[model samples]
Target: MLQFKLVLLGDSSVGKSSIVHRFVKDSFDELRESTIGAAFLSQTIKIKAEEQEEDVVIKFEIWDTAGQERYKSLAPMYYRNANAALVVYDLTQKDSLVKARSWVEELKNKVGDEDLVIFLVGNKLDLCEGEEDLRAVDTSEAKAYAEEQNLLFTEVSAKTGQGVKEVFRSIGEKLYASKKDEILAKKNRELGNRVNNSVDINAQRPSTNDTTTCCS
Candidate 1:
């Protein structure tokens, strides 16, 4: 089983905790309490590899951080070794998207891992359902930014459990693929070393059939 540290970041009341709750518990609360410092949760998912017929078990160690300004300083601590991050924004709030972009920038700078998968998520789809005017943030705009920043982007409603499962599933698939690549690279390196060592040993071995006659 492979374990990955994942973190959620966004502005206050952007539904970061709600999304995490929905993904983990498969339920939602209308009056979900705000997260304090950070909430810890874990979920194990089984994903099938695309190329091979094998099931990969991925356990996500989720850190749902507080979105308030006071907790902004502590964000780095939670995401220090995070393999992936979900930068969420509320669909009803335009400023929330701005905050989400900032969080993405911070993660890129602080995490500094090129392989770290960052997702730009728009939450609160329930609020905008059937009321396009209620959406303050444009989907095309968010998606354009995500594309420019090379991020995974999606819109989900935690309340109705819409697009919630796909978010985690995508992350699992990407993480599993990365792990597989790493393992293959390591094995290749080990094989190369063994071949080099064998060559060295053969070169050092003395010739068994020395045919020089000393006294003819």
Candidate 2:
């Protein structure tokens, strides 16, 4: 079993808590309270490899951070060692997307890790279902920026459970793939070291033809 630290970042009331809750508990709250500082949650997911017989168990230690501007300074502490991040924005609020972009920038500059898996998530799709007029953030624009920045992009509705599962599943798949790659690299290094050591031993040992005849 492998554990990963996952963090959520966005402006306040963008349904960061709601998304986490929906994924972890499979439930949604209409009047979900605002998160103060950060909320901690954990969920385990099993990822099966298409080409392999074994399944990987991933345990996510989720930190649903408070999105208020006042808590902005404290975000780094929560996301310090995060393996994956969800930078969420409300589809109905264009400014939320702007804030989401800022969050992404901060993560890149401060977190400073090329291996971090980030998703630019547009939330509140339920609000734009029939009334597309309510959607303030254009999906294509967000997607374009995500592509430019090398981020995973998706829109999800916590209320209707649309695309919610896929978000976490995508994260799980990426994390599992990264872990597998890391393990393989480590094994390769170990094998290389063993081969080198074996060669060194052979070079240092006396050949049978060169051995002295002790009792001759």
Candidate 3:
């Protein structure tokens, strides 16, 4: 069992808790409270690597960080030594994208180019298709940024469990591969490089705009 801490960061209503619930409990609730500091959960995702079965017991450390601007500066503390982070955004709301971008920017600056695995999630996919399309943050824009940052990106609907499994599954694989390389190479620099290559954010989607954004 590999112990990895995965933090979730985004605006309060962006569905960070919902995604964690679906991935960890395999269930969803319409009414859920915004996380104050963080909550920890353990999930065992089976990932096969190098023809051997590996148990990826990610701590699934769902840090439903406070979205209040006052609490914003404290985000870095949660991610300080985390293995991965899930930066979520409400697909139906463009303002959430801006907040997500800022979070990504901070992570990029603090964690260095070679460390930290980021899962750029566009949440509320189920709510995206019906009401509006005038200036929705194109999923592609997030994908492009993830690609540049060498992070993973996905569209998820926490309500329906769509893309929920894939998100955890992929992150688990990357983290596992990283641990294996680091263990075998016996060098921190090499380990970071190997892990960085494991991420192909470009492998995911499609294109961008001046997405409206807000941390509150």
Indicate the worst ten consecutive residues by lDDT in candidate 1: 202-211
Residue 215 CA displacement from its true place in model 2, Å: 61
For candidate 2, the TM-score is 0.84
Candidate 3 at residue 67, lDDT? 69
- Give lDDT tens digits, candidate 3, residues 153-206: 999899999999999888888877767765444335444756888743422211
Cα deviation at 146, candidate 1, in Å, is: 0.2
| Local accuracy of candidate 2 as per-residue lDDT tens digits, 1-216 | 567889999999999999999999999999988999999999988888775678766778899999998888889999898999999999999899999999999999989777799999999999997745699888999999999999999999999889988998899999778677665565466668687765544334432222433555
Per-residue lDDT tens digits of candidate 1, residues 1-216? Answer: 568889999999999999999999998999988899999999988888766567767778899999999988888999898899999999999999999989988888888788899989999998887755589998999999999999999999999999988999999888777778775565466668678765433223322222223554
**lDDT, candidates in the order shown:** 0.86, 0.87, 0.75
| Candidates, ranked, lDDT | 2, 1, 3
For all predicted structures, in order, the TM-scores are 0.84, 0.84, 0.76
For model 2, what is the error of residue 166's alpha carbon versus the real structure, in angstroms, after optimal superposition? 0.8
lDDT, candidate 1, equals: 0.86
